[model samples]
Target: MLAVGAAALVLPLAAGAAPTAFAAPVSAPVLRAPAGGYEELMVPSKMGPVKVQVQWARHGGTAALYLLDGLRARDDRNAWSFETNALEQFANDNVTLVMPVGGQSSWYADWTSASNTNGQKTTYKWETFLTEELPAFLEGYGVSRTNNAALGLSMSGPAALRLAALHRDQFKHASSLSGPLNWNAPGMREAIRVMMLDAGRFNVDSMAAPWSPAWLRMDPMVFAPELRGLPMYISAASGLPGQHDRPAGLGGAYNTANAMGIEVISMVSTRAFQSRLNTLGINAVYDFPSNGTHSWKYWEDQLWKARPHILNALGA
Candidate 1:
């Protein structure tokens, strides 16, 4: 079982809990369509209220696609909306785009213990917040309760798979782009520890005990069988610089080198997980491009490539 910290238990909003600047009532917010293009809602959770950005569908479809972010997710806006043309790509699609903000290095998991990172103490209860609280809250605002799909990149890639595997009835389809699926693989734990540290001085050992059963429990490869019948899409790059890469000078070269190393690890882990899925006879759309690196360009391409499948799964 996943360990829950004492401070992570869900509780009623205290009498004088801190009020959010934009929305009233720390527990719930009035859900309304954005005045312009998108709206932000503060969904209450055990850890605190989570800010979810919603882009209403032009066709008013009830189905939703939850898009998670990577280790460096910002609190301002989802990288999908900020860095890419995802909003424009799905403008005509008949599905709501749900993006949860600010989960840097959290891995979107329920941590065993509260962690102090950069001097801020947080009890990470992202699993409960996303799967339980956020869904229920979205349902009240006309989003489909069960007809949902999830996709993530990098750090959140495995999280998307694990959520779909464990809550098969909730998500109709799932996808991951450049995510590490095999958590317990050799050297993976240490790699994650270093990544977390680099991301925000986060300690991975506090999120899940080192080499514990919880680690295995969260590994998508270990639960590959659970995702057998789900319409799934998985993609990864070979860590090689392609047309999208434009190395300028020494700084650009250094950045590209770092990206290559991370993508190589992701490629190895994702391929191993995909191999397991194939061995288990679980059919999924696999996109293993030989020349792309771990960049938003590839993720954006994969999103467009998988758009039809995702919409089909949602019955759109």
Candidate 2:
């Protein structure tokens, strides 16, 4: 149960050992006729809260795509939610848009060490919340579990793959947009640190900690062995080997900043990690569009592309 830390989650501890509590989400927020022309709902989640948006037929679509957040992405909104007019995309189709509210930088792991004591932490019991709580709620709300898949961007990329990989019964399709799948690399870590610092949201304890053996154990790549048969859909920007802006030459043949000694963790190519997947016979579908970068524009397009895969996974 170490992986399932209890009582430590932010909860109230009364003198009489009573429970701590937050007013349970009475009425989740939903905005119909979105400004961008979609139905939007700011729903509560175990991780915290999510903003669920739908842009399909009025029949309450059967298939779903659970969108995840990046390290700096906020639960309040998303790149697609803020920018695109998703409602226009589903005028002819039926699909449910489910965005779980939290996990910025969470890497979407069943985090064994990131809860609050006494359910008091703003961060809720997410893994349980997502896999069980949220799913049940959605089912009640008319979402069919039999036709649900997940897709995320950047930091959430690995998670999208992991969820489907680890729980094929629940999620048959998963995808990531501009995500750094091989976080075990040095250059990738540094790039992340730089982004964290720039975003002013970098917390060593929050990002990765030696004290929390849970972090490593939660990583998807490390546990890919447990995830088989789940189809993976990936889209990422191209760049240097996990490291960007590398100085190169003929002798540059042997240079690597990704401490793991991955011959070349290509930011421009999904080489390193894909090779491993190839070995495991898990390369379902991957794309390294020569034009995309690790940015919002690329992800928007990537999400659009992954939508078909999401539908396929949902068997819709």
**Candidate 1 lDDT tens digits, 159-225:** 9998999998789999998888877676667767766776667888778887687777788878889
RMSD of each: 7.7, 11.0
Q: For candidate 2, lDDT tens digit of each residue in 1-316?
A: 1111111111111001222333333244332212222445545565445555444434556566677765555544554555444434544556666655445445666544443322324533445555676666666556666667888765667777767765666777878765556656545545544444433243434445642565555555676666567767776555233333232774333222221122122242245667767788775688876543344445566677766776666665
- Residue 1 shift from truth in candidate 1, angstroms: 32
> In every candidate, how many clashes are there?
0, 20
Local distance difference test, candidate 1: 0.77
What are the runs in model 1 whose C-alpha is more than 4 Å off? Answer: 1-36
User: Against the true structure, what is each candidate's TM-score?
Assistant: 0.88, 0.69
Among the numbered candidates, top TM-score falls to 1
Q: Model 2: how far is 4 from its true place, Å?
A: 35
